[model samples]
Target: MRPTVTPCEDFNAEEDAKALKKAFKGFGTDEDAVIEIITKRSNEQRREIATVYKTMYGKDLVKDLRSELRGHFEDVIVALMLEPVEFQAKELHRAVSGLGTDELSIVEILGVHDNDEVVAISNAYEGLYQTSLESDIKGDTSGTLKRLLVGLSTGRRDESCDVNEEAAVKDAQALLQAGELLFAGTEESVFNSVLCQRARCQLRLIFDAYNNLVGHPIEKAIKNEFSGTVKDALLQLIECVRDRTSYLATRLHDSMAGIGTDDRTLIRIVVSRSEKDLEDIKEVYYEKYGKSLAERIADEEEVPSDVKKVLMQLLL
Candidate 1:
């Protein structure tokens, strides 16, 4: 229940604005001052600071920061500055807009958000790009993955915590029959249909019931039955339904696991979750991996020193 970043005590908009102006005034940027103000305040507070900064001085804070900062640190700060929903919208747009597509980015955003957040992201996407996110996704993706992204964009899933045990039982059977019980190939539609509409709470019960029905875990069956991006998304949804914190921790790990760091992915997760559940994510990260999330990031040679320092400011 603890978010790493909280609203600062004795916050003053003009004072913060003045401090930021001073940070940007000298020969060199006061990165520590920038990081301190940006990381300590909540997103709402940050927005207020930006507004006051603009009102006090005719200069735009983001533009000034842009002029002063460079590289991944700038990316993180700017991303942090946007409204969360808007940031998500831009991330989705980025995921689809460029050559090829970052299918996993779509999954990361769409899979994690609930009905309202999803709708908000969709609206923000259109507002920012003056185009529909659904169309962009359709253009970029195909097959079941396309369907999944489009489905998630609707924000129609039941967002309640209410559980229906009987329905859960039937859904469990439907999954078993669709996957493991039938030797005749899996019915992927059944998965897509059920996953698209079921409430997260209901999905959890369905998963539990499925486990009880099948001797093994539902994840194993999913791995056996599905393939490609859809399979990864499904597994992530299941993971989210099971333990969101652990899922996010794995995401943090996966971002840094390979040859080079996924700076955008890393920044998005840390920044988005920083004020929400980074604390819980950190706990899960430590419990899953031997080292803490900060320790993991700190060890990554790819992350620049300033980037790592700013990241640690958020983490600790």
Candidate 2:
């Protein structure tokens, strides 16, 4: 995956900090100066700048940015400032903490992350909140969703890239029996065991085998057999495993679509993917939506110019 932010050649954390301090000084904030410095620098550089800013100025960089910036712009800056795992942990906490669960956020975060990424987020969540990520997920969700999230939070998915053709066939047959062949309903544990535990490469092969066995895509089978949050979560996992970039592209489109922008979702995707796959996401977004992400953001009157500028920089 191509990253939008590569390290600057002459990166100096103290210089960047001083530049930022100058931006925030005097009668009015130099928003452009702030944007140029924060958005162009890589996340590692930003973290270093934050450290230097604290050491030199004795002020928290985030607090200073918060005091100067407002609304979605602040959201962009703050998200950019956080370590990736920490940001993901905070987003997951926010998703599960409110009155009703943000199931999509929960699914997106948990389903898309690989075992190591999940482990990092789980550890970060615990470190940040003084509680287990799994416990929060368990309390916030119920039924199959709770089961799936709790299981996924363990980060125990088989990470081997090797595929076993025989095992794939058996898993495929097992899915058919557990879902379509059952008289009452699908077997939840069967679905969990195969979907949650298999290596992603193995899961791909199994999905192909499943299509051949069932005479339809595994997704179609999943749709026919399951419903509600469980169905959504499972399908998201399949989609994420199959093509993570497309999955994220779809997410970015969803965040910006209709009514008003889901700022949290927008910020999360932009911030998290900026240093990982935002470049590929931008490509997929254009191919899928027939308009560049930057163009789409440029057209949105609701997004403030400062926030849009920062987002566009990340897209670049």
What TM-score do all the candidates reach, one by one? Answer: 0.96, 0.96
In model 2, the Cα lDDT at residue 94 comes to 93
Candidate 1: residue 105 Cα off by (Å):
2.0
Instruction: Report per-prediction Cα RMSD to one decimal.
Output: 1.4, 1.3
| Tens-digit lDDT track of model 2 for 149-232 | 787788899998789999999999999999998999888888888888899889999999999997899999889988987788
* Alpha-carbon runs more than 4 Å astray in model 2: none
Candidate 1 vs. truth: CA RMSD? 1.4
Give the alpha-carbon lDDT of every model.
0.88, 0.88
- Per-residue alpha-carbon lDDT of model 1 for 1-316, expressed as tens digits? 6799999998998999999999988699999999988988989999999999888888788898999999998999998789999999989988998698988778778888888899999999999998899998898889888887788788899888789999999999998999888888888788887888899889888888998998778999999988877788888877876777888889899999889999989999999999889999999899889899999999999999989988998897
